[model samples]
Target: MTGRRALRAVQAASGLGGLVALGAASQVWLRVAVPRDRPLPDAALALSGRTVAPLVTALAVAGLAGLVGLFATRGWGRVVLGGLLAIIGAALIAAAVPHAWAPGPAAVDDLLTRPLAGRDPTRAAVATTVPGWPLLAAGGGAVLVAAGLATVARGRRWPGMSSRFEVAGQRAGPPRAAPDGPPADAAVWDALDRGDDPTL
Candidate 1:
């Protein structure tokens, strides 16, 4: 694809990646058990998940910024930015693995042992598994990385925002109508070019 199209695709992918990461960070990531089976389960935030939510959010924000910058940048700048995006994707992959970082049955035991005032620890099943947000985030990161690669490959040929939005080149409507006169008389500048002056 053309550089301009590649850049557009990258922008779209990066935005999508940011949105996905935001969802994971803002929502519950896990559910822990209680003393006995209860009507509701204990939910855990992304901050308390296997991977830190802030890190994921930060990567996502960077990815989004990269899209904005991609439109403005070319040459090696795009390559460097793309490499950063790749690193973010790698970090996401790493974060999703190595389940040891996640809290296991102990988290449930604590809640069952002592619930806060006005709260009761209902009998819930022990939760030894982590939620799915990390995986989702990782998938988004992967897509973002692909977009970054596209930028690196073809960004130099892409047009800058300023060039596309230039006032001299931009048109908001149909072409302007010519003056109601003969061609030689209508465009005095053209007539002057042919050794004739309209005023003289």
Candidate 2:
């Protein structure tokens, strides 16, 4: 297609990718909590490891901000934003890949005694099997990275906010008051009066 149209297409793809990334991240966080029995025999269970919520949350927010910058910032600013976006995407992919395929025991492994691995583990103590959500997150991250790279390459040519979007300029000095009769005239002088104490 045309050059501008291509640029817009890239922009649109990037936005879509960012949204997917956010959704996938949320899914990972909400559905994938690893269960680990507390170190103490009687303490409450503690969860940790293989959890991507914080990273995902951070990337998701970054994705949104980068999207805004795509339209709000220009030149170097846009380029910098694009670079950051790419980094976030790369992080997502890196974070999720292992979980999807080779997910470690996460917190569950740490808490359980060697026997826990073998015993028809108690429902309360067992962690959920690594789900496919991580794969989705990784896919989303990949899209974000690709789009971000495109943005970095052609962001200068991409469209941005209109000139009208800028704040209105302020006048150099305070506005001149509307003409009132004659300045310093008798009528204007409340205390000091005119020769006749001019009728108000």
Per-candidate TM-score against the hidden true structure: 0.60, 0.59
The residue-by-residue lDDT of candidate 2 on 104-174, one tens digit each, is 45454444434432233333343343446667767777877887888788877666665444543432445
Query: Any residue pairs clashing in model 2, and if so which?
Result: none
Give the Cα-based TM-score of candidate 1 against the true structure. Answer: 0.60
lDDT of 1 by residue, 95-130 (tens): 544332445555545434434332344443354444
**Strongest candidate by TM-score:** 1
For candidate 1, what's the RMSD? 8.8
